[model samples]
Target: MLEEKGIKPAVVAGLSLGEYSAFVKANVLSFKEAVQLVKKRGQYMTDAVPLGKGAMSAIMGLDRQTIKDACEEASILGVVSPANYNMPGQIAIAGIKEAVEKAGEILLEKGAKRVVPLQVSGPFHTQLLEPASIQLKEAITAISVHEPTLPVVSNTIAEVFKDKEQIKDMMVKQVMSPVYWEDSVRTMIDLGVDTFIEVGPGKTLSSFIKKIDKTVTILNVENEKTLEKTMKKLAELEA
Candidate 1:
């Protein structure tokens, strides 16, 4: 649909599960293959840890170092680490349920505004997901990937997919690594991507981009209404 309207992105990226969409957009993977692989990937992640044993929480109004220190202090109980560096003040931490709770308490004492638990299946993007990442590596080994026509930013390393050979390795690492969303956005802005069009549902990424850099134009295409609005906005920008 975007192609039919003569709009082509200079670079592409997405957050966590959305990274698969970025691979498809950059021609690194086909849509069909990504869909099929994701099913097995989901199973691997689920199998990595038992339900109710893991937890994630969002700590608001705290800097990264403070949160890191809190997580470190709480790690003696169990594995705990910062998962997603979403924006400046909002960061998600994940690990064993008890450890996450412990870290939340520490952060609270250290002046964090609030700690909100997230409703997710497992403690993703943490060392706890290493088993899942190993299984994911083997799963992607059979599939063939190609060099992307355009740059595709990665979550693990807030940088473009420069090496096709390392794509699988990066995917393996991505499963158990923090998503550098803030750095990734800065990388895109450095690459001269001033306008961001989120082609799928939700305004989450759009909101994140706005917080990162209010100077950029952000749009989303979910339902027909949003699609038409995005198209008209793109036309105006091109003019």
Candidate 2:
């Protein structure tokens, strides 16, 4: 659809599961391979933590270092660490249910405006998911990956993938590493990206981009109405 409208992005990046989409767009993984890999990855992650044992929570209105410290302090209870550095004040922490709850309390006491628990299957992007990461590495190694036609920023490294090997390695590490979303967005901005079009079912990425840099144009295409609106906006920008 974007090609039909004569729109091409200079760079591409994705968050969490969205990274697979970026890989597909960059021609690094075929649709079939991506689907198969994701299926296995999902199963591995699900199996990594027992049901009711893991949890995740969103901490808002707190700086990154404070949240990190809270997680470290909560580590005594069990595994707990920052998961997604979504934006300036919004971050997610994941780990054992007890540790996550403990960290949330600490975050609140440390001046966080709000801490909401997230309903997720496992404690992702933390050491607890190391088993999943190992499984994902084997799964990824079984598949063939190609160098992207355009640079694709990595959530784990907050930088463009250097080569196909790095892409494979990062895909594995990303399973157990915090998503450096803000850094990735800033990197794109530094590379002169003024317009960001999120092509997915949700507006989460668009919202994050808006919070990251309000000066940049943000658009999302989830349905026909949004697609038309985005097309008109793009036309205006091009004109």
Candidate 3:
């Protein structure tokens, strides 16, 4: 579909399972390989953490440091830490159920507009997910990963991973580290990428990209209808 539309991505990045898709799109690995890796990631994440013991929450209208301070003050018996730094004032925290609950309470006390708990199988992108990282590392290292044709930012550091080895290491660490998505979007903007095309099952990334930078042209392709619209947009943009 991308080829049919002549929509060449100048900078492609992804989140969580979307990372594997980005790799496939970048031609670093085949789609089959990427799917297999996601299966492994899903299995490892589920098996490493017990159900209902882990949780996630979004703390809106708070700075990163304030959220960090809140998490530290709210830590109870289990692990809790910031997971996804979505945008300037939005961040997702993840860890033990009790810890997340405690953190939410602290955020509310801090005058945060909203603290909403997320439905997830595990406390993703936190220390609690380290075991899954270790397991996934072995599988990822076995695959033949190459440098991306376009700049592909790492969720772990919000920087473009230039080397294959660095990409491997960062991929493992990303399982247990916060995704600096806000920083990533800014970085791409600094690099002069004024357009973002999100191709996947959901429109979540496109929404975040718009929230991060409304001035940039954002197109999301999931179904055939959206694909056709995106093709038309690409033609107009290139013309």
Flag clash pairs in model 3. none
Residue 146 of candidate 2: its Cα lDDT? 99
In order, candidate lDDTs are 0.92, 0.93, 0.85
**Ranking by lDDT, best first?**
2, 1, 3
Q: Would you estimate the TM-scores of all the predictions?
A: 0.98, 0.98, 0.95
Give Cα distance to truth, residue 5, candidate 2, Å. Answer: 1.8
Candidate 1 vs candidate 3: the TM-score winner is 1
Candidate 1 backbone collisions, by pair = none
Candidate order, TM-score descending? 2, 1, 3
| Clashing residue pairs for model 2 | none
How far off is residue 165 in model 1, in Å? 1.1
Tell me the lDDT of model 2 at 44: 96
Instruction: Write candidate 3's Cα lDDT for 1-239 as tens digits.
Output: 88665657887788866777778878877888888888898999898789999999999998888899888887865789999998767899999999899999989998888998897888999998889999999999778888878778777787887887888888788888888888888888998988888887888778888889989999878889999898888789989
For candidate 3, which ten residues in a row score worst on lDDT? 3-12
